[model samples]
Target: MKKIVIAPDKFKGSLSGIEFCNAVERGIKKQIENVTIVKLPLADGGDGTVDALKFYTGGKLIAAAVHDPLLRPIQARYLYAENEMLAFIEMAEASGVRLLKNNELNPLETSTYGTGELILDAINRGAKHILLGIGGSATNDAGMGMACALGFRFFDAENNLLEGRGKDLNRLTTIDTSMVNTELRNIKFEVACDVDNPLFGPKGAAPVYAPQKGATKRVVEELDAGLRNFNEKVETQFGKNLQNIAGAGAAGGLGAGCVLFLNAELKSGTELIKSIANFDEQVKDADWIVTGEGKFDEQTFSGKVIKGVLDSRTNQQLAVFCGLSELTAEQIAAHKIDYLAEIIQQASGVEDSIKNAGKYLEEAAAQFAANGIVSK
Candidate 1:
């Protein structure tokens, strides 16, 4: 029997990778006979990171009460795989932009204290290895709030405890780690990061991302200055400069915090997920692979799931089925993509396309299969 691997990333605000796999299977099975179908729902260390890991590892979700980005009490969850003693934590669960209202999207006021609490919870639960997905953050505090929750105190020049927020970073005079969780020293951290923005500058976290998180232009400048000051303090405290470290700006400098506070190793998010899934080994003999995401723009070629799947193997009959296919023919050819199946081709409008994403994805896969895209 011919074998096919159906792997897709979440469609962002619509279907998840697992849903995509099921939809595609429902369609392709209607066209193919005596074929083996493999469903591999993948994530790139974003919102669905924990779900993907839980599915792959058969891990248990540990519900924990934590604070949200705005420091309001909220509920969050993380995955713990007992066999491996690994904790898969998506930082967005505690500090995502989606948790805030439009008026409450102020980056300067948000905090990652809840994410730190989750980490501490995992540590106390006997997790020796941690994979933290730092994405979709709503703060630009240089992770001072996270540090604060981990018992790393931040004080002003007067040695008074200052609330950890973006606006307070510039006023931070010292980082005290004397009271940090004792279990932290024995744990290992692997941070999932894809962006290469530095900790502070034009392309840095505050200037590039803070505005999107609801900072005004003037506020962006202030947050950038604060991040720079935070970088200096981090260097003084850790004897390593992170101002220019690639991916250091991720998650309001939570990437840098993981490195300094937890001695984390930063890695590409998709690549890390692929490793955990054992993707290459599992699909070594697959006849064809179908993969995609919400949209396939230029950034998809850089670090997203599509690029990650393509990098895993060459000379395969791989096709991308997405909500929209923005790659030009030349770009597609350069990447050796065999076919592009876009749901928009079957749906009337973009809004309707997303509204009925499962139906469209099923139709797209059916058409692609009818044309021998996957059957061959």
Candidate 2:
């Protein structure tokens, strides 16, 4: 029997990581009989982080009431893998932009408090190591709200409690860490992040990402100034500046808060996924690899899942095909990808394309499987 590994990240707003693997498995089995299928669901520290691990670990989901990005009451879930005593939390589930309405898209007003609540809940559950996925955040508050939830205090110029939004950080004069949960000091945190943008500057959180969360030009400027001010205050009070720290801008400075307040170690999201999925072991005897995402552009070459899959393989001549929204022949050539198939090109609209994505994926996989034998 030939061994085949069906590993893929979530399709984002379409299929979960497990579902993607199942779909791929079905397609592969249709063409190859007596094939051993290994499903390794993957994530890039975003919405599906918890689900990806849950599929592999058979973890229990614990739900808790937490605040949304806009400070609204909402329910979020975290996973606990009993065997490893590990807890997985997706920051986006608790404090992400998707939870907000159009009018509620205010970077200056949103908070990461809900994410903190989830962390505390995980700690109380006796998780020795917490894997935090830092992506798809809606706020630029420098994670002050999360710190507050974890027992840190932010005081304004008048020594009054600072409340709400990234803009409020402009008035921050001190950071009081005296009330932080001492229990958290012993726990290990692994922050999964891909981007390396720093805390506050041109390439920082506010300036680079605030606009995506509905910040106007003026709002972006205000939020940028606020983050800069917060950095200065933290430096003055804690004798540490998070400015220019790589991945510090992830989840709108949630990464920085994890590093500074939670003592977390940051790692590349794709690298972590590759390690957990055992890509090296799986690819060692594979005949070919099929990988993709929603889009395959120049960005795909920059430490994305596809890049990780390619790097794991020792055979440079191994067959690889990418399924994407659209593709330029030149772009595919630059990445050294063997073949490209555009699913969106065959659909009518965005909604239709997403609705039929699974079917299209199956078709593409079947084609790849058939081609593999012919090429051999």
Candidate 3:
């Protein structure tokens, strides 16, 4: 039997990676007989990381009570593999920007304290290896909120305690880490960080990402100053200079904080997730490989699932099924894509494609199998 590997990322607001795989599998089965299909739903260390890992690895999903970005009570989940004593956490589960409304988008007030609680929960459950996906954050606290949850305390110039918000960064005068959860020192922490922005400066967290998290032009300047001040304080207290580090600005400076507080290493989110999924080994001998994202555009090559699949290809035939294709034929040819299909082209319009994405996707897959695969 021929082997087909279906690996895809989520279509953003539409279908999930797993749903994409299922729809493609169903379509493939309808057109092809005596074929083995391997479904590997993947994520790039963002909102769907835990769900993808859990679906692909059959890991246990563990939920805990935690605070949202606004410090409101909520339940969040992480993926745990007991035998490996590994916990995979998507920080967005607790402190994602999507959790807040347009009016509530103040980065100065948002907190990653909830994310820290999830990490602590995993630690308490005996996680020896913790993979933290620190993407889509709503805060600009420089991971101060997270550290506080792990028992780090911040003090102001007047010796007043701080709550670790973006507003507290400039006021930060000292850090107390003596009470941090001792277990954190024993466990290995690997942070999924793909960006290369430094902790503070023109391309840093505040200038580039603060606006998305609800900062105004004036507030952006304030956050930038705060990040700079916090970096100096961190270097003085921890003897680590995080401002110059690559990926230090990721997750509103949580990347730098992970390094300073948990001694964590920052890694490429796409590469890290692929390594965890054993993606290369799974697709090595496959006869056909299928992958995609929401839009087949330049961003698809930016450490996304399709890029991982294309980079790992050998002699296997590849097909891409996306919601829309923005890549010109020349670009597609440059990337060496064997075939491409867009659901928007198959449906009545963009709205119809999104409304019945799975249906159109299934039809596209079946047609691909019949015309593209069978014709070969």
Candidate 4:
């Protein structure tokens, strides 16, 4: 029997990684008999990281009361594995830009306090190890809001207590950790980060990502200045130069905050997830490996699940399935993609493709199996 591994990331707004795997498996089984299929759903420590890890570890999702980016009360969930004392916290659960309306996407006014609440909740419940996925953040406060939620207090030069927000960063003079949870010191935090942007510079978080979160050019400059101020304060107190750390600008400087405050280690999201899933051992002997994402572009080769899969494959023929392909023919050839399946080809348009992604994916997988898979 031919062994096939179906490893795919979540198709944002359409299907979960596991759902994608199921759809592909159903389609492939219909076209091939006498084949063993392994469904290995994957994530890059972003939106669906918790779900993917939960599926692998049989963990439970725990909901907690938390604040949103705007400091509004909301409920967010994280994956908790009791036996392992591990918690997978996707920062976007509370501070994600998707939670706000387009008109409400103001990075300067946003806060990551909600994300801190999730972390504290996990820690209170005996989570000794935290895998934090810091992506899709809405705030540009350098994690001041998150740190505040964990009992850190910010003060201005006048000794006025300040609320942690992007607008408050420029006024930050001191950080008080007197009330911080003592348990936090004993916990281990591993941040899943992919980008290499520094905390403060032309390519920093504010200038590069704040505009996407609805920042005007002026607001972007202000946010960048605030980040620099925050970094200066951190350097004065902690003696760590956060501005130069690669990936320090991720999630609106939450990456740097996790490192300095939580003593977290930053790691490639894809590689971290792959290690947890034992990806290499599982696919080392497979005859074919099928991988996919919502959009196949330059980012797909940069610390994404598809990239991790490609790097791990020894002799397996690779087939890529995506909602849309942005790669040039030369890029495809360079990556050695044996078979390319696009769900868009099986649908009417982008909207129709998204609305009926499972159906389209099934059809695409079926087409690949019938035409791309060769008899051994």
The C-alpha stretches of model 1 lying farther than 4 A from their native spots are 373-376
Q: What's the C-alpha lDDT at position 273 in model 2? A: 67
Determine which window of 10 residues in candidate 4 has minimal summed lDDT: 367-376
**Candidate 3 lDDT score relative to the true structure:** 0.90
**Distance from true location, Cα of 67 in model 1, Å:** 1.8
255-374 in candidate 4: lDDT tens per residue? 899998899999988888888889999998898999999999998888998998998998899999899999999999999999998889888899999999999889888888888874
Q: For candidate 1, lDDT tens digit of each residue in 1-376?
A: 7788987899988898889999999888888877888888888888777777887888999999999988999999999998889999888889889899899999889999999999999988889999998988998887888888888999899999977888888898898888988888899899999988888888899888898899999999988898888888877877889876789998888888788888889999888888888889867998788998988888887888888898876556887888897889998988888878888878889998899999988988888788865445
Model 3 residue runs over 4 Å out of place are: none
- Among these predictions, the greatest lDDT belongs to 4
Q: Enumerate residue pairs that collide in model 1.
A: none
- lDDT of each residue in 34-126, candidate 2, tens digit only: 677777777776667778777767899999999898778999988899888889888888888888888889888899999899999988888
**Number of the top-ranking candidate, with TM-score as the measure:** 3
Return the candidate ranking by TM-score, descending: 3, 4, 1, 2
Instruction: Estimate, for each residue in 229-326, the C-alpha lDDT of model 3 and write its tens digit.
Output: 99898788777889879999998999999999889999877777788879899999998999988888998898787888888899999999999999
Residue 113 lDDT, candidate 3, scale 0-100: 96
Ranking by lDDT: 4, 3, 1, 2
What is the clash count for each candidate, in the order shown? 0, 1, 0, 0
lDDT of each: 0.87, 0.77, 0.90, 0.91
